[model samples]
Target: MSDAVQSVTIVEVGPRDGFQSVGPFIPTPHKIALIGRLHAAGLRRMETTSFVSPSALPQMADAAEIVAATDRLAGLDAQVLVPTARHAERAFAAGATHLSAVLSVSERHNMGNVRRTPMESVADYAQMVAMMPAGAAMRLNLATAFDCPHVGRIGADAVLALLDPLVAATADVEIALCDTTGRADPAQVRALFAAARDRFPEVRGWAFHGHDTYGLGAANVLAAWDVGIRVFDASVAGLGGCPFAPGATGNVATEDLVWMFDHMGVASGIDLDRLVDAARAVAELPGAQIGGRVRDALAARARKAAA
Candidate 1:
């Protein structure tokens, strides 16, 4: 808190989160282009793709090729979601520097997501970390941390309890508390963040990822930032949704969140104009749509300027 933030790191998840939602296979070229566009936009941290089963998510079938394309970019912390040891090895081989180990805080949700218990998933990740290449980063994304469709309103104790085992098992791992269904309100977000900071003082990284289902994603993100947490995960133009959760909506839009920080003079190290263009380009993908208002506004502004 001593030095002012000239820029912030908004982890671009559109390539992974946004592309994975659609059912059909998106061409490798387009996926590579989207990643290239985001990396070129000065977005330092980005989730390039997921190394899940092709049968499950055909959209991410070309994950390795995407990683092979983007990981070599300069100053880029390209990440890939690795759910198992198999995926971890593949991700590492494909040239992923950052690995995201995804799990849900809600028991039923975790079961539905990866078909494993929360603690079981944690144990799996511990082994994966040991085998990971030297200096490769690992981030654990705890989805459904706030509320779950299966079990509404997860209490703070339950969240802490789920994390306790994971924290004990893993050393030097980053934790990302997620509003998977976008059901979290600002009050609960601040309270949980405050408690996590208090209990896990030694935690090296504490990040947040929220959804816009209840129209509170940006508010919750700002609330988290107010409490001294900096890292965020967003989809370009808000082009993401949880396919597993019914009615689960888009992740907080990259352009809109950047707009908020820009107006507030809080630098996120992301270029707004270029980010809007990236969002627009991703929205053009088959079955993809732009959900962020800022990107649309940017288009209109571009049109008026040309006029």
Candidate 2:
């Protein structure tokens, strides 16, 4: 409702999160092209790839190559999801200046996801944060912070507890509270974000990553935006989900989120037509599942206007 809410930041995660969900591997060139197109579409922060084991996530096997190829692109801040200190070092080795370290708030999900307890992962992440050089950027993505498939309803207090280890370590960090399976409600979203802001004033900014498993991804984004959250993680055409979590879908579609903000007169700084074109291209890639309403509706509207 205010002028400050008029502008926003969109973090393109299709190349990493979406592509990783696909069964077949997307070629490095396809990954690079999509990221390039996303950048041209006005996304500054993009998760290009992950430094996890290729055996585990074959889709991101080209992580090193992607960073090698795209790190120098003008105006694009390339980042990678690092699973450990070694992964973080490797990501930095591949010319990535921005790094994301994930820690799920749900102990059940954390054990299922990374085979570590929440505290164990926190200890590991502390080392990972220490390992990074001062100039390197970081974002702590708290997966299943809202709710987990294995354990439902992670309260705001538990989320703030997970933030304690990293909060004491640095003042230059950002947070991405993820609804890994898209079960997050708007009320809980507003509460958790507000709690995070109050508990960790050291956090530089906040972002939300939500899946559409429950069809609340877009609504959750708006909820977060209402509380002054400007950055978001999205996959073009709703292209991804957790490979480990059954029935999970993609993050809120980048195209749909852009359309939501644009209609509300908010400047997300994203090129809608170009983003839709990129989504269509991503849909053509091997093993991609496309389910974004905006892209399809835009196509229909174009035909209607032409008629």
Candidate 3:
């Protein structure tokens, strides 16, 4: 790895994506507390919430309240996921400094998840990016970039083709390739990142959003890292699953990823002990279950040391 890749940015998506997957609504205060704990655990970048219709995702109905509650976290950059221009407006009003727009690479998955074709979603994203407040930054999350549950395998060329307009529109636009269905392999991950690096070299940053459905999220992360890709999207305690993607699992656990990076001599700037404690707290929430191996291992080690 080059000196330029000395550090990686871990975007904590637990409070939003993680909690959203846990079904039964988590109280607004509990969500706020989780974000607070994550901030205290050395996470600076976080996807705080999404401003989509509550009718669609009742779990995130408290988007406004969640954003308000997290206003006190000094030095934390809170981002909100927006599906449309209207959602972006709502997020801006709710005090979000960063906004992320999503478009799936697979047409079938895009229609299933966002109710639009991939092309239509990209058009919407371009419009949203154009209308974004000059002060706020916009990112595009290319969901199902690897392999789509509904559409089988997706080629790296297809992924780049979808990103063409977004890349041409904005030089610094960041794109996150989401393994929404967690079906991506290390080889696929390597190919996708390499394609992005080679084709869309102007892209500001490349992010990986992997799910543990196949239990290779961290391995894929390692593969991407070898090719100069940094900035990952992880949920605390492995919280998150796509309702549209059957048999999908939660994201790469933030605690588990941090532990992997720390042990591998890679720097993520996250405190594993504090992150594990946060994961335990999240696990105690109603309908929430802890989903990371490192968290469990750390707990066992701590108990043994105490004994």
The best candidate by lDDT is 2
Candidate 2 lDDT over residue span 208-282, tens digit each: 998877688899998998888989999999988655456656678999999998998888888999999998998
Compared with the true structure, model 1 gives a TM-score of 0.94
Quote the lDDT for 256 in model 2. 94
Better of 1 and 3 by TM-score: 3
Which stretch of 10 consecutive residues in model 3 shows the poorest summed lDDT?
241-250
| TM-score top scorer | 2
Point out where model 2 deviates above 4 Å: 242-248
Q: After superposition, how far is residue 179 of candidate 1 from its true place, in Å?
A: 0.3
Q: Estimate each model's TM-score.
A: 0.94, 0.95, 0.95
Report lDDT (CA) for all predictions. Answer: 0.83, 0.85, 0.83
Cα lDDT tens digits, model 1, 126-210, are: 7887887778888989888899988889999988988887787674888999988887899899999999989988778899998
Please tell me which model should have the higher lDDT, number 2 or number 3: 2
Cα lDDT of candidate 2 equals 0.85
